[model samples]
Target: MADIVDTAVSAGSFTSLVAAVQAAGLVDTLKGPGPFTVFAPTDDAFAKLPAGTVEALFNDIPQLTKILTYHVVSGKVMAADVVKLTSAKTVEGSEVKIDASNGVKINDATVTAADVVADNGVIHVIDSVLLPA
Candidate 1:
């Protein structure tokens, strides 16, 4: 299997997300040998943001990196394990709330798809992009 970066790129729906990851200079990190659990958002989800938000972020590398890393957890946490947790600490050094009482939610985003395995980790498709506190 490909790594997380390749996996997302191949998914096709994550164009905006993949670009953001690249702009943030995190391509190497995501492509590294780490079992990261990424709550990946689709291009449509990014469109949910107000106009100019994405552009503004792209100009701010630090903020973009923070927001991007906020979508990731340090280890590979599968959907089954994620459902059992109330929260998980993000690689950005913040905690994201997890609510599995219904489907699976990471903060305000709903998990649309789950357990997309990669060589370096897993991907859980979220309906919204996650932001840091």
Candidate 2:
């Protein structure tokens, strides 16, 4: 099985997300031996941001890294486990609210798909980009 980065690349819907991860210099980390749970945003989700938001993030590595890491949790928390929780602390050091009462929401983004298993972790597809306050 492929790692998170490879899995995301093969999925083909995470182009913007993959690029942002690379730009943030987090490719190795995501590819590492961690059992991460990533709330992945699709290209369409990234497009929902204001004009130039992505471009500006590319230039701001620190901010980009924060936002990217905010999508991840430390362990391989699958859909079943995620639904049982009210919140989860992200890799970015902030807690994201999980509202499974209504179709599973990670912060303001809805989980469109769940439990995409990768070698190193799991990916839950979300409809919007999650930002840390």
Candidate 3:
């Protein structure tokens, strides 16, 4: 099995996300040994951002990294586990609200796909880009 980075690349729907990860210089970290749970946003999600938002983020590595890391949790928390949580602290150092009462939502994004297992972690595809406050 491939790592989180490779798994995302193969998914083919996260082109913008993959590029942002690379641009933010977090490729190695995602590829490293981790029990990470990534709330991955698809290219469509990134596209939903305002014009030039992505481009501007690419030039700001620190901001990009924070935004990217906000999608990750330290442990491999799968779908079942995620539903049980009201909140989870992200690697970015902020807590994301989780709501399972009505489907599963991570912050404002809905979970479109869940439990995409990777060698180093799990990936849960979300419909919107989650930004840290």
Candidate 4:
């Protein structure tokens, strides 16, 4: 199996996500031997941002990197493990709230697809982009 980056590439729904990761210079980290849990936001999710937010972020590498890194958490936490927690800290140093009362929610986003295995991590496709508090 390929890494998280490769998996997202294959799904073809995370175009903006891939670009953001590239912009953040996190491709190598996601490609490394890790067991990460990625709260992957689809391109559509990014569209939910305020108008021109994506463009502004793309223009600002540091801010974009921070937002992108907020989606990743160390360790490959699968769906089951997720339900046992109230929150999980991200690589970006922010904690994302988890709600399992109805399906699974990560902050304001819902996990549309979960437990997608990759060589380096697990990808949980979410419908909303997570922002740092």
Better of 3 and 4 by lDDT: 3
Clashes per candidate (backbone, < 3 Å)? 0, 0, 0, 2
| Tens digits of per-residue lDDT for model 4, 1-133 | 9899999999999999999999878899899999899999999999999999999998999999899889999999999999999999999998999999999999999999999999888999999999998
Query: lDDT of model 4 at residue 14?
Result: 99
Per-residue CA lDDT of model 2 for 3-60, tens digit only, reads 9999999999999999999999999999999999999999999999999999999999
Off by over 4 Å in 1: none
The best candidate by lDDT is: 2
Name the better of 1 and 3 by lDDT: 3
Show the lowest summed lDDT stretch of 10 residues, model 3.
Answer: 17-26
Report the lDDT tens digits of candidate 1 across residue range 37-109: 9999999999999999999999999999999999999999999999999999999998999999999989899
Question: At residue 17, what lDDT does model 4 achieve?
Answer: 96
Q: Tell me which residue pairs clash in candidate 2.
A: none
Q: Model 2 scores what on Cα lDDT?
A: 0.97
RMSD of each: 0.5, 0.4, 0.5, 0.7
Task: Quantify how close model 3 is to the true structure by its C-alpha RMSD in Å.
Answer: 0.5
What is candidate 1's CA lDDT for residue 97? 99
Worst 10 residues of 2 by lDDT: 100-109
Evaluate model 1: give its TM-score. 0.99
Model 1: per-residue Cα lDDT at residue 66:
94
